[model samples]
Target: MRTVGNDLVRSQLHENRKWYLGLGALLVVFGIVLLAALPFATLTVIYIFGALMMLGGIIHFIAAFKIFEGGYRWFWALFGVLYLIAGYYAFSTPVKTAIVLTNILAIILIIAGVIRIFNALLFRAFQGWGWTLFSGILTLVTGVIILMSPDAPFWVLGLFLAVDILFQGVNYLTLASYIRREVPKSSAEQ
Candidate 1:
């Protein structure tokens, strides 16, 4: 198993660099487009949420029949019932869900920032660690700002989302580009 894993890794290590670079470019472009359409994007998110609720309800109703046929009727029936209830709640309180989702995003960003800061600190023992520290500090600041302003309107949330996506997209692009340049020149080259 270990040998198989090693072989897989070795094969991947020799794969063409253009694939990673292309993916990175796509991410960057997506981020830019999302940032550019922040206002419309918020509405799109709300619509998607509503659609998901309707779909969930339909799926649950279908599952109820399947569960009855399977003879473990009570357990799956309970799941279907709960799902229906959640679907109703989603349909009735979509605005509330949107607000909660925004808050969740803030919390997630804060957690991610804190983790990155910790990782940067841990990696500081290694050489050439300044860039990591800088990135960590930037992320921490962004997270703190978002968390402190959790009551921000949809526009503000959209703006934050745009910035976050753009930053991450640029980060990934830079990493991919570096890998593309470094890999062919290194010993891992096939």
Candidate 2:
């Protein structure tokens, strides 16, 4: 049983250290570039989203044919058409789509914040519960600010995407370094 937490995984990561390093470097570069060109990155994200929606629509259309149930087939077909329409709309009016998506994100964040706060409060005895409560409050405030801001939609998603990618890149780099350091020690011990 070579679980990810074990030495086998560490050995594999050591073996693939170069790949992780390269990917981390690439993502870090991309994140920095996106952060530099925030507006362009925002539009790029919308375009990518539109393309994904179009792909999803096509998949749904194919699925409709594969589904033998009449109601399911019709439902898939209907949703496929809707997805295609939405994709087209996104492509034609990306800025509007971004704004709409950002607004939705705000709503989702608010909901998540409330849920986190409720969980933290309900599980007061849990270790680090106060941190969870603090995080929830911050999330709630952020969501409120984003929702209220007229200019938030123009850059919020792009900023979030850039930051997420940047962090992921750093995480990859850290994992690679850790594996590189520890694997040699483990090998020597064995």
Candidate 3:
């Protein structure tokens, strides 16, 4: 039997269904646009990263003098200089930076995949272990493919981001539709 609280909850959901659907549609559109212009998106990310690194270096430099002393001050200053040099290199040669970043990501993923797989094995007695194993294998495969491909670094990040956004949008749309379908109807309406 449906309770008054259930009906109220359903009504609330019904009221917000349009907002969910609208946001989902907007995200879907944005994801598609980003996917279409992937190279530009990739470069945009690189440039943004470069800018952030530069900003971080400046902050470190300021902190060194203002917040540190002796060896600590020298350490922060050195760190800041390294950051600035790295940031400048990134900005000056984005393609090389992307390649380096992509390789690092691939290596990390591979290591994580291996670790997850082992963890899943060690915890095989637990529920959901199979899912963990599956995820590990999938992650491993993705990393291997990216590492092996000659040009994967150039576009993998952009493609992954586009797909992630697309899936999130789909999830929102599904939730909105589910809410609409689940709303309780009055006896007369039923």
Candidate 4:
């Protein structure tokens, strides 16, 4: 009976540990992908933002035609006007949008790095803490560099984006690997 109980407890503990490790690995993979896609992502985001804005504007203009029908028509009209204005603003000052986007990216990187570091700290009592710590530090440093160079030109920002994406990709891949390796076979199988 004692042996059986011990075995059950050990199995449960192993499964829990594996689950946590798997989560960590997933986070690493996510980070890596984010870093790798950072370069092209900026342009993609800008294009998408512009496209959405334009689409929204067009929709609003179309909806404005129905305003005469009443039933919250004024609200729709107001929204339509705002959407049109926003779309034009985005189109007319793409550079400004780019700048703001860059800043946002930098902040996101920093925040992600900080979160990774915190995760590492939380798991300091556990084995394999070093990986989390290293990833966290790397992310934090990269984020800081980007933030410090806020005035970087569009090309520079593009470079940063690429680097960020690469790093994030690496992080994610590493994390995934760790999870695969560390996760309990039983837990994973389940």
Q: Could you say which candidate leads in lDDT?
A: 2
Ranking of all predicted structures according to lDDT, beginning with the best and ending with the worst: 2, 3, 4, 1
lDDT of 1 at 103: 69
Native-referenced Cα lDDT, model 4 = 0.66
Per-residue lDDT, model 2, residue 35, is: 93
Q: Write the per-residue lDDT of candidate 1 for residues 46-137, one digit (tens) a residue.
A: 55666676677667667767645665666566666766666566557756655766767767777777777787788888886777777767
Per-residue lDDT tens digits for candidate 3, residues 1-190, read 5666676666677778899999899889878987998876677778878898898899999999999999999999998998898889889998998889888889988998999899899999999999999989988888998899988767877787778888889988998999878666633334
- In model 1, the runs with Cα more than 4 Å from the true position are 1-40, 60-91, 156-190
- 102-189: candidate 4 lDDT, tens digit per residue: 7777788789989999999999999988899899889888778776874543544555545554565555556555545664444334
Question: Top model by TM-score, which number?
Answer: 2
For 1-190, candidate 2 gives per-residue lDDT tens digits of 4443466655666768999999999999999998997877888888888998899899999999886478999899888999898899889999899999999999988998999899999999989999999999989889999999998878888898899899899988987887777565334235
Worst 10-residue lDDT window for candidate 4 reads 181-190
Residue pairs with backbone overlap in model 1: none
Model 4 regions lying over 4 Å from their true place: 1-45, 56-86, 150-153, 156-190
Q: Scored by CA lDDT, what does every candidate get? A: 0.64, 0.86, 0.85, 0.66
Model 3 regions more than 4 Å off: 1-26, 164-190
As for TM-score, the candidate ahead, 3 or 4, is 3
Judge candidate 4 at residue 166 and give its lDDT.
55
Candidate 4 at 180: error in angstroms?
27
**Least well predicted 10-residue stretch by lDDT in candidate 1:** 181-190
